[model samples]
Target: MAFSNPFQTYQKQAVSTSRPEELTYMLYQGLVKYIRIAKNSLENKNFEESNTFILRSQDILSELMITLKTGYPVTDSLLSMYDYMKARLIQANINKDQQILEEVETYAVELSETWYNAMKEMKIKN
Candidate 1:
């Protein structure tokens, strides 16, 4: 059996490194952090806190994408998926929808895992 560092293995890899580290790094970090918080809170039946984390995560993603002139490889379907998930997150927050929140939390974890895995393989870091 082998043990590996998941954090190092699953970080997001940006296509270009010309930008400042803060611009490239913190958004991704925030995404990763809030997703975990949301997931954990939902699993614990803490709906309020989970919703908060989801909103925070959405804000981070919105902020990061706002200033990007060069787009990365998050394709149209994925972009639509993000928008849909983000909307569901907001709806969950407004309606106190636990089931939807759990679903979104699961989605976030999977997406983050995929993003991190690719980043790890590409050897990109802050």
Candidate 2:
């Protein structure tokens, strides 16, 4: 018999049960985490691990772009930001540059915080 990790199971449940706004916040959080890991790994001279994490962060950006609604005026700006971040991640991965990773991490953190605040305000209004 195989054993499943409780934390992994819990994370799966959390994601499965989360509302769309919550999922967006989670994605932003994930992007920040992966970028941070990639930066740390790069600083430690772990190129392979850094590359893997960078790719993961890029995937999150792609997912965000795909799921974004087009009717909103802000959609274009958000898409542009996601594209820029993904490009920065590619540059960081290719050059093994921690500075570039830091730049993306800053954007990710800001976006995550903004999303969290919006969710909070939504809850209060409803």
Candidate 3:
């Protein structure tokens, strides 16, 4: 039998059991990680590697946009931000621009921190 990595198994179980809020926070964390890695790849002149990571980041942003509930006022604003980030990611991938990737990373960091704080507050309340 082929062996599966234990960490991958743990991650799959964690995601399957995570609440919606936790999932959102996890997505933000993932987006930030991809952008940072892409930035490093760009700096090293690894254009293909950078493009791959940028695409991953863009995919996560798209998933977040689709999963977001539409009724709330904040949803519109968040959608706009996601659109802007995706556009920047495309531009970064096309031009291999570290600056554009950094801009996207800044947004990702802000979003992740905000979501993490909200998650903590919800846990405290419950």
Give, for candidate 1, the lowest lDDT window spanning 10 residues: 12-21
For residue 93, model 3's alpha carbon misses the true position, in angstroms, by 0.9
| C-alpha RMSD by candidate, in order | 9.2, 0.8, 0.8
Give candidate 2's whole-model lDDT. Answer: 0.94
lDDT of 3 by residue, 1-126 (tens): 999999999999999999889889889999999999999999999998998999999999999999988888899899999999999899889888889998889999999999999888988999
Worst 10 residues of 2 by lDDT: 68-77
User: On lDDT, who's better, 1 or 2?
Assistant: 2
Query: Per-residue lDDT tens digits of candidate 1, residues 83-126?
Result: 77778778877776667767766776676666667666667653
lDDT of each: 0.68, 0.94, 0.93
Tens digits of per-residue lDDT, candidate 2, 1-126, equal 999999999999999999999999999999999999999999999999999999999999999999999778799899999999999899988888888999999999999999999999999999
On the 0 to 100 scale, the lDDT of residue 3 in model 2 is: 100
Per-model TM against the reference: 0.56, 0.97, 0.96
